[model samples]
Target: MNSSSSQIDVTLTVKDSLLGDGNTGGGRYNYTFDPDLIHVTEHDTEIVYRLAKEDQPRFRIVNLYSTDTRDQLDELEIREDGAELKIVHRNTYQQLTVVSLLVHDTKHDHPVNCDPQVTNDPPPVGP
Candidate 1:
């Protein structure tokens, strides 16, 4: 398949309500995307992924980032099982309105250029 089509790009925004809850030890949030759209391997390391917030909060006390590691950062964990991607928030609390998740294979020498437009609406609540 083509390089651009092989890339996986997803943007997520937490609702205002969820953002508020983030202040009080945020709970685990699950996000699922189509596995068929991108390639998936048994090993998690095959996919190079990065997650970040589109807008930063005012306070530095809270930490916001995406990780696949379990209980590493303030008990914050992010797990990926095939098509499913789970987000966990630990000790720190902050509002993450806009989230950008990019995933692509590392085997390719050329960069995967898939930049989706930003949206204000939050991602769906359920898995």
Candidate 2:
């Protein structure tokens, strides 16, 4: 979480294993998002999601929407090339926001749901 910059870049990559086993038709591939918890500071204004493997049949960001109505996002733009998403945040009071990503696995033709958190509050200290 770079407090100096107004924009944050989150890289999304496919995980190694499937969600289920052969019983579930091989299942959907899981994903790993760098900076899994987006610590959006007061100065941060935007979030940019980029694919880890460009032009690969692994995963594609199909749609993005806020699970919570009180989310801080002001705008969401999916790029024309289906490569990235530019999301602008509404800087109001501090709160935790949940954003869902509908990712399409081009290789398996499956849809995977990814929920990443955005928050202005500092992460809790360890035990």
User: On residues 1-127, what C-alpha lDDT tens digit does candidate 1 reach at each position?
Assistant: 0112223343332222343333112221222322213322111112222333421121111223443243312322334321223332221222222323433222322111222221111122124
* Residue pairs with backbone overlap in model 1: none
Q: Which ten residues in a row have the lowest lDDT in candidate 1?
A: 54-63
Q: TM-score, each model?
A: 0.21, 0.76
- TM-score of candidate 1 versus the correct structure, residues matched by position: 0.21
lDDT of 2: 0.67
Q: Supply the global lDDT for candidate 1.
A: 0.26
In each prediction, how many residue pairs overlap at the backbone (N, C-alpha, C within less than 3 A)? 0, 0
Across 1-127, the per-residue lDDT of candidate 2 in tens digits comes to 6444678889877654543632222443556678887876544378888778653456677888784465567778887465678887765556777788777777767776777777764323124
